[model samples]
Target: MRQSKRIAIIAHNNKKRDILEWAEFNRLFLAQHELYATGTTGKLLEQELGRPIHKLQSGPLGGDQQIGAKISTQEIDVLIFFWDPLEQQPHDPDVKALLRIAVVWNIPIACNRSSADFLISSNLMHNEYQPHLPDYHDYLERNFQEHAIQVNRELPFPVGTV
Candidate 1:
């Protein structure tokens, strides 16, 4: 089985409602994929959309760290962070790290609703997504074809040569 790209939804206190609305709008696409979120945002989205979600702590309560770990592990493919640019986050380092990792890893990230909408509305989300559980066999399988071609090119005698 292959793993679907993991997506984490998070929001600042003021943007929670917006995140919920976005989640509700894209529930079908989201439901088929794994959802991780900060505490209040997760609860709210779950209640409004009638969907169960894996909840992490509140962002101020180490939730951002959780996201950072997932991003570093390449477990999180998209980060929908609805942040309030005006608010001063006490855990600023966590926020910085989360965004930094998202950039460093080249994974898609959305800091506002506009970007979030663009991401969820992408063809990748609209099409059917095969759920990959626990193992990333599918991701590996998808990459294998390219790797095989590269391997063949690098071999002086061509691949599978005696």
Candidate 2:
């Protein structure tokens, strides 16, 4: 049996067409996987592709954070985000956070059509591949251990907050 992946799809307002077109072109390939997307994008994609897509809130309305949380919990396997760099967005921070979480989780992410093509076409997609994920528990434990010596010491504002 082929390994079916959980793919998260997102697109900025201006890039929706491009993402839709890309998804249409990759219909068969995408049909083999589980699909998820933000509200508006998911609706559009469902309308265009005629496929079932799990829909979350709109990006600016907490969808990005939802996806980020999914990444942190290892629920998502791939991300296809066609963001528009030419335009500024009100939810830019959320977008960046989502991308950062994907990176930290060590999942495959595609920010454009070329990369998406490569990711989907890769032979690894059909197989069970283990990614080198950061040991977050170990990292937190190390931090706490390093700070154990300063337990009695009062600090100023937290580091990097100033």
Q: Lowest summed lDDT over 10 consecutive residues: which window, candidate 1?
A: 127-136
Model 2, 10-119: lDDT tens per residue?
A: 99999999999999999999899999999899999999989889999999999999999988988899999999999999999999999999999899999999999999
Q: List the residue pairs that clash in candidate 1.
A: 2-132, 3-132
lDDT of 1 by residue, 46-138 (tens): 897787888999998999989888876767878999998998989888899889877766677889989988987777655544433345568
Superposition error at 69 for model 1 (Å): 0.3
Report every candidate's CA lDDT. Answer: 0.81, 0.91
Score residue 86 of candidate 2 by CA lDDT.
97
Model 2 lDDT vs. the true structure? 0.91
Give the winner by TM-score.
Answer: 2
Measured with C-alpha atoms, the lDDT of residue 60 in candidate 2 is: 99
